[model samples]
Target: MSKSAVSPMMQQYLGIKAQHTDKLVFYRMGDFYELFLDDAVEAAKLLDITLTTRGQMDGVPIKMAGVPFHAAEQYLARLVKLGKSVAICEQVGEVGAGKGPVERKVVRIVTPGTLTDSALLEDKETNRIVAVSPDKNTSVWRGHRCKAANSKPS
Candidate 1:
């Protein structure tokens, strides 16, 4: 049986996924990252992979796809680089929490510039990210700094 089979936290995560049925959420489950239902369908389409389904929850079939935990940063980088916004759901308690279920919530949402893990970023090139406000009058830019000493003669 999978960890999710006996864990209420996993069930709650699934609930959260159901709420955001439109976006592809990287639901972090234990040492692997997973996608459920429509998110899985969309990710498989976008990533060019097979679409598969998992167990039923609340009488509805759950679609899923996953990658190892260690590889998640890299995978997330690729998705973000491809202009996909991702919400990261993280488990909040230690392994043996006995309080009905462990606590879990979205630790952060990964966007282009907010990425801090060096393993998921390029060292030589700048990772540029832009945010445009809904009003169309405001904009924000975030990225690494440019070195004045490294400037080339024009």
Candidate 2:
């Protein structure tokens, strides 16, 4: 399949996924958050959800998996607990707003290190954010050189 063969919606998804290759993309589609390709494969295994092939992209089958929009919180919490980052892509435009696919954007990126949502955090545990910076100055140590003394053979 060629680039032209790919659907507009998929093209939009690809564009977002390209920017967030390190995170699983929860792409909003209708009433479900869909994951595609490698995201689909990894998320399906991690979330214990069904993995199915939707269509094709560039001659390869496009793997897909999804969770219902209404019950996404539990799934998201689990993913975060297991040290996975997710990019939440939501439909920003109305259904009848335009002629082509409705405009969508990544509204939020949730990661294990950046957990702030009450739903994703534990009630009793304390949360901390740590920032590590490299030292800009390099230090040089000075040492005294010693001359070797000649010894007589015994």
Clashes of each: 0, 0
The global C-alpha lDDT for each of the candidates, from Candidate 1 onward, is 0.66, 0.86
Q: Which ten residues in a row have the lowest lDDT in candidate 1?
A: 145-154
Q: List candidate 2 segments past 4 Å from native.
A: 131-154
Clashing residue pairs for model 2: none
RMSD of each: 7.2, 15.9
Residue-wise C-alpha lDDT for candidate 2, range 2-110, written one tens digit per residue: 5577888888898899899999999999999999999999999999999999878987889999999999999999999999999999999999887878999999999
Clashing pairs in 1: none
Worst 10-residue stretch by lDDT in candidate 2?
A: 145-154
User: Candidate 1 residues 61-106, lDDT tens each?
Assistant: 6677876778877777778778777887877777576766566677
